[model samples]
Target chain A: MKRKHKRLTFVGLALLLLATAAALTLSAFEESIVFFQSPTDIVTKSVSPNKRYRLGGLVEEGSVRKKDDAVVTFRITDMANTVNVSYRGILPDLFREGQGVVTEGFFVSDVFTADEVLAKHDENYMPPEVADALKKSGKWNEMSSKMKKQGHVLGGGSQ
Target chain B: MLHRFANPTRFLRIASIAQPWIAWATILLAGTGLYLGLFNSPADYQQGESVRIMYVHVPAAWMAMFCYTSMAIAAGIGLIWKHPLADIAAKATAPVGACFTFLALFTGSLWGKPMWGTWWVWDARLTSMLVLLFLYLGYIALINAFDDPARGTKSSSILVLVGLINVPIIKFSVDWWNTLHQPASVLRMDGPSIDESMLWPLLLMALAFKTYYIWVLLVRIRAEIISNKIRILRLRQVHG
Candidate 1:
């Protein structure tokens, strides 16, 4: 009986140790967690200029400006506000004016510098985090109508 | 629960009756899910045709974690109560879980090249998911390493419980780690951020994958129970 008790206690302790270690590792990475902020939040919060974060909204129509080489400048808008973004890379084929886009980077003065950008390839798509941010901003209803019309605007092609 | 279901005759009787329905559901749901995900859903405006990968990748990823979690819970029951059925359940689940994890990684990589511009990255979520796959492989190997089935089950049960720690880590890795993977938007405290048009399909796919896992797991567990019975019966016939 004593031996059985000892074994049970050992196993219990081992499980506890593993759980604690994993929780610690998870919390340590918290600073790296990036949450999506709308153009309005970016404007109002005066978010730290260099801190890495995400900006998600529709690309303002007629705001895309292709610069020399791969460089491009555009504006992201949540209808409440807009932020300018400059990116230098091969843009995804789906990237266009007036489409949902999420970019990870931070603000530098008036320009929002993007290190990476996400472009959905389908009509029924949204980045899980970006969606949360939009719902929090009370702009999800506005986006839903736009998503329904996406098929009509994108040529109604399956590909 | 394990003791009541441990007897192979009892298990066989229950599983045999359920097997055909489980098989049919698996077939039906998988077909419907594939049709809707592939043919009906509209192509992403930005991703073009590649967005079709999401339907498969997301479902597979979800199953990978869900399978491991079920295995771990079975292991815990086995260890705490020495329940025979729990060990068998854990044994049956490991390979299936590993396969799902492998599929998730495979599909994620295929999707990543065009989207992230790289086939592999040390992004928190991706790396953690890879670790989960490795953990599943490790459990499978540990269980089969020994000649003695009881010894193998006992040792591997411990491993499964230890590996359970990784599940939460995987779920929160995107939130905690500064990695390329995006944070959670659909499962959140405030509410889902995605539009209903996109959210509904993803949710449907998620449910379809979950239901399919139960169907597959039940089938696999029944097979294991029958094999165990055959081994015991053969021993008795030879000795008699």
Candidate 2:
């Protein structure tokens, strides 16, 4: 019995150490994470124009327009506020209107110029930052309609 | 020929005979791969020196997936046939797969920082690969979770079999989703998009890693089987 107890305790301690290490690494990575901000937040906060940040929300219906071969402009709206964005190069297949996206870049001359854009493949999927932002705004359900339209069976029922 | 080595004693004998040959091949292939990667292969016109990471990252990723598939198949054999050695093979592969997954992720991140301009991206390919690493760790954890080794083996086998879905997901991620990660070049319907000079070394390194996996698996499984026999003997001695 004592021998078995010792082995069990050793295994338990090893697991605890492993879990702690994983958590520490995750937390460290989490701190560097910049949550996507909506245009509303950007407007209200008057965020520093030079600082790099991420903006995520739905690409507003009929807001995308091609400016040139190398430049394209669109609006990202959280349904309450919208920010104009300009991007260069070929867009991802999932970069359709009314889809959730996250872009990391900087604000230049009152316009958000994205250097990188991200879109999800699955229907119910929302970027982590977008989910957190909606939860904080108390409007995640209202926004999740987009998710529902995309066939998010699990998230659809919560609303 | 493959079935012949399914017997543990036969496997041990064959492995002992083949060990030196495989070891030499591994060394020669790896040495040549490194030399070609370092000196002969042309740098990407776009990516420059960072492209060297492809030599490591691609092989590690391939081996990570290969090891998991091998493990899951071994688990299946163990569950269905109650093959004594199959469970040992499955259990022995967990840490090796985990290490390969870690290497793939690590080399990928190093490559990503310069190429994609980020250390990490939640791109479909990247995310599913990350999930694979987690699955490997989960398998390792679950296998040791129970006091009864048999219980642990059975449960973890189920997990491994279920987690196999992530393999296809990783492979088709770029096609299924919009991701920063590039689509297949070497294994595509079209001929390899890569230059021949680079392709040869990468293929050789991949073979080297595969042989390395077989070598390590044999050594570890043999150790496990021996340890299990020792454990049974010790238990009998205690009871006697």
Candidate 3:
């Protein structure tokens, strides 16, 4: 009985330590999360112009412009709203108009000035956030149908 | 019902019959999955060929989470019901879970540098996953830290039950915080958000991983039981 009591105490102490550590770590991160926002989210929410964030969507058709050197500018849209993004780095090889793009940068004077740009290169792939942005803005049926026509089958999972 | 299968003789008989079938299924499914992933699947529109990494990465991530979950559940049974088999099963699962977690992180990093422009980020999702790997290592270490095997098992099982708090956090990390990691389309609402062509390979790989876990787990448990038997026999001979 004495040995069993000691084991119980040890278990309790371990639980206490784990709970403390988890609580501290979780609270520490509560203030420092970078959210991936959609174009519609940018338009509706007042994001600080200087704070860095990730913005994802399909590049608007015919909106990509190659400027001097490697710098380029484009408009990304969730079909409900669009945001302008400018980047100076060499774009990922897959960056193209009418494709899913996720950019990490800051807003300067309402323009998303991206430092990095990532494209969904799969001929059939759509980034989930971009898809959600379109769906939440109620343009999914129209756009998703068009995407489906491109031979992109919706992935299998529980609805 | 639990006690009925607690006998090692019964477990060995059942596992012997189940082993070959599970092993072959793993080969068949994983082989098919590799072929389709490497050849049949279309190059991603954006990431192009690099997206094929998901055939391995996503499944590994799933197995890492799956193994930890089953271990925790087993550990809980050991704690509450004092089931020796439960603890032994949990012990056997640790290294396997750790390997899967490591694969997830390694493959994810390889996928990341080309896709995210960086091999790693201190983002919530990535950091939480790294923590999970550490937790697995810690569990394995703690289990062996003690001289007495029972003490080691008891303490580690307690640690495991406590470590389980991380699972939900890992699953929701992307959603709860802003992250470079893509949000889950495969396990989320309104069905899979990704295309079906990619989804099939991912699912098959997941099944293959699960089968691989069971095959290895049975072998590990059998070895553990046999080692224990040898230890007991040696002790009896010495005392007599």
Which structure among the candidates has the greatest lDDT? 3
Per-residue C-alpha lDDT of model 3 across residues B11-101, encoded as one tens digit per residue: 8889889999999999999999998889888765456688889999999999999999999988877776677788889999999999999
**Structural similarity to truth (TM-score) of each candidate:** 0.70, 0.65, 0.77
Predictions in order: chain A TM-score: 0.56, 0.61, 0.58
Q: Please tell me how candidate 2 rates in CAPRI terms.
A: incorrect
Give the higher-DockQ candidate: 1 or 2. 1
Residue pairs in candidate 2 whose N, alpha carbon or C atoms collide under 3 angstroms: none
* Native-referenced DockQ of model 2: 0.03
Candidate 2 wrongly placed segments (more than 4 Å): A1-112, A115-159, B1-4
A1-159, model 1: which lDDT tens digit per residue? 675677678888988988888677656654343335557667887678868867766688899999887888999876668899999887755576766566778778889989888653222355455556778998875766554343212211110
TM-score of chain B of 3: 0.98
lDDT of 1 by residue, B1-240 (tens): 655687766876888788788677667677776777777666654465687787778778888989999998888777776777778888888887888899989998898778755566655678778889889899888988998888999889988888888788777665443344544557655476455645556666777777677766778788887777798899899999
Q: Worst ten-residue run, lDDT, model 1 chain B?
A: B174-183
Chain A superposition TM-score, candidate 3: 0.58
* Model 2 lDDT tens row, A62-117: 99899757898999876667889998866654577766666789988878999887
DockQ per candidate: 0.14, 0.03, 0.20
